[model samples]
Target chain A: MRSVTAENITETFIGYFGKDTDPRVKEIMASLAHHLHGFIKDTKLTHDEWRESLELLKWTGEITTPERNEFVLLSDVLGVSSLVDMINSNPAATSSSVLGPFHVTDAPPMALGADFKRHYEGEVILVEGYIKDTDGNVIPGASVDIWQTAPNGLYSSQDDEQDINSFHGVFTADENGYYSFTTIRPVSYTVPSDGPVGKILDATGRHPWRPSHLHYIVSAEGYRSLVTEVFPNDDPYLDQDTVFGVREDLVISYKPQAAGTFPKEGFELSGKVDSAFSKIDFDAILIKK
Target chain B: MRSVTAENITETFIGYFGKDTDPRVKEIMASLAHHLHGFIKDTKLTHDEWRESLELLKWTGEITTPERNEFVLLSDVLGVSSLVDMINSNPAATSSSVLGPFHVTDAPPMALGADFKRHYEGEVILVEGYIKDTDGNVIPGASVDIWQTAPNGLYSSQDDEQDINSFHGVFTADENGYYSFTTIRPVSYTVPSDGPVGKILDATGRHPWRPSHLHYIVSAEGYRSLVTEVFPNDDPYLDQDTVFGVREDLVISYKPQAAGTFPKEGFELSGKVDSAFSKIDFDAILIKK
Candidate 1:
């Protein structure tokens, strides 16, 4: 018999467990062992290499805070995050996207057609959309929560000292399933490159820019909620979204229409610009309950 | 066009990354976004749930030390370790067994018939084996590195922390591809279950115990090397190695032979018992170089 050594410690450890146990746990554990052993055997992995991987993971945990989730980023970069999502997300709803590292709670509720441009300057685009079921029935009283980036490419929350919700709002659709919000066109920008995910990108020689877009989560009784993004038709990064989240139907045309021809006159910005820079009619298709 | 707000901070962050980027980065990032978004969207996974997972990983790192590897243990119990092993262990050599997690470099080399039980006591069984090509030709100078648990069912390295190399040795084959080592019979025992792996085991309600066995790594200049474990014939745990590392061919039998049966002066057990307890012939098969 061979004396145990550090190299076989993993096996030595597993050699202790009894066979009578939950099959799921056993199967998963076995699968994990196969992959991990494969990695070591394939690489004939050295001790130092193992140590480095462990150390890197340590750094991954050390840098994560309540606000900054480096593990999520790590999982994201590893593709496990998405794999887990595929296993759980609603198959009928619009395909779910990555839950990024920055969502905080407690958004104030507001009404339709309300101005969400709390304190940012950009083209005041009227975002008019309908929340309808797949069968084309309007989902009246649907709630649509929306958010976007500043023209300077930063979120209000990114600045701890700022009171401005530069690009955030919560809006409820009217009885006719009509929803609209007044806000500025968002700008395309790069993700923060100071985290481990960023370091990995740097090491791998990759960029981190995302195209201009607006975020929306529309929900109502008796209808499937839709969490989606609408992108500008002409944004250069539209074709190169770092996260591969672009869908053709999800891209809205930014038409420069006449400002005075707009509906629902609040009596402001009579001639905001020589011509309306863009007016996009963005609607969502929610599944019937 | 909604303004960014505190409530949707996470979504805004995800949106910022999911919009656009290089094609290479896009595919990976999009998949990540989709999955992460899927986790939150599907589990309705609370922020605290996400934080808890991160904390679990953080503790996994904190508990790891220079002498112990928790992540590998995690990977092992998860089965990634064996998956990796299965993928990489070549089909050509005598099937490679789990390396386990305790191999250390710098083993002291010895000649044929040398003893490995310098600081332990048990039935002095003589283990002799042949190293040959698949064609049965003797391969001289092949090294047989061996180790086993002490009589108390613990590995010397695990129990005798102060005694370096207590039950580990390397023996070289003579001109006839024959090698021998004197040692006590390894006893079945439980593996360490005092860490996170243990907690997982307890949560799942599983016992831990490995059958009596001997570990061997055989290597010759012109033959493929092999790493394997030989289970004691009929050991209860043979069918339930917690690590799932048992292979039928690797099991050996112990026959009660007559005293002085060798009838050869070259191989003799000193301080032999009047009544022989157990004796066995163990051999290994190797592939061509």
Candidate 2:
């Protein structure tokens, strides 16, 4: 386009989109161009900044792989992921949180109320949750996928030293709309910062620490699926999650319980030589599809 | 940052900057965060869109190399490069244009009036120019670097079949502040469209063609360097350059000349050319440093 000035470049850029383009694509591209141009104009972004920013993106892409998505981490640190969660969130349902780059699709299935088949040593906590509709009625047979970091604060995918499926398990809600799992408490961990995203965080003196939490992806027939996490209310990082994924309702207490607290019947944990442990009772709420 | 809703996440993200952060970096980062959040909220961007955008970036990075910079193409097509040039431009000086990714660091120096050593054949054009200050006084001993696409409309850097220094030359204005070059006239060409940027243009139904022009970087001892291009006014793509790099003031005409009209004195083409040629007369003006 001729004579494209800073003031007119936004619309001009969007105008390049042909009339045959998808309306939704046009809208998204237009808004992105508008806001991007606005940012540049507002900052009068210097040549050095522009060049360096592009370089940062280039390096971020270079560091990305199938198992490690630095782009998602970039979005998470910038709070775009959480902002998207918040904007697209359904208030009538359990709040969705940022899904960090650690979740994989190959977690082995587990029986309800059973511990994942792991022999790691740590404070074992039983996370018990029920699936319910907006009307407070139970959704029996709801599907639940759960994952968490090891006690050392590393997800299995991030630490090759750990099993690929460590702390990962899946189950279906019982006829009573309940699901449970026994696993080591997830510890607060830093987002992998050995790459470009880490440089950005370091440049601004920001920390990459995320609060300890258990990841969950819950769904059922006739209801919307919910991807979320439960944070221990006591986590020091709760107030400053690097990804801004924390929701007050999603924070719960790991209450100390007696040795017999973990269910024995219909549960593999079943008092099998267990000591004192904590239990987190949470209910996942969903809205109708 | 607690309570990070879409409305407040912008400020929260910015507030993460530590007190010790560089003020300039803080301003740039804060403005970027604000605009990015605004775009997300404005678009109410969907999950699929967010995910797809990240994937697009990952692919763009995967394709980048030392010779090929897809990010520059990304920025150029979106008009950020041109807008930056426009805003950073000194109105009294020769207008600046996108440097583009084709420029190499090592162009061999040519004499005051000479042709590059390329053996390619096409419409030979005599390009002559004087370097001057904003007040219109010629600046003796000014440096000028020139380059352009081959007759086939592909730059040496883009087409491996061509010499690495094809059509590239460096020059120093003589005591008279005049310099000239005899090279094949550049033709309209499409930017490399075999990457993610091409995919974007394809999705938007936007063409990738750029107008024919000669690239120049001119500088004097006491004047600001000027990075610009002189476009042929008659070029069909002059009004539709994909990069929005055309400046009305930078457009020039190529006038026909007799077979022997090409300069012979202090020029390499001196009577060596047996065919009629066109000539372009343009001047580059620079502001005080």
Model 1 error, position B147 (Å):
3.5
**Docking quality tier of candidate 2?**
medium
What lDDT does candidate 1 reach at residue A12? 52
Candidate 1, B81-155: lDDT as tens digits: 444444434444444555565554467886566666765667666677787777778788888888777677766
lDDT at position B41, candidate 1: 46
What TM-score does model 1 score on chain A? Answer: 0.80
Leading candidate by TM-score: 2
Q: Please, what is the whole-model Cα lDDT of each candidate in the order they appear?
A: 0.62, 0.85
Task: Show the colliding residue pairs in model 2.
Answer: none
Instruction: Show model 2 residue runs off by greater than 4 Å.
Output: A258-263, A270-276, B272-276
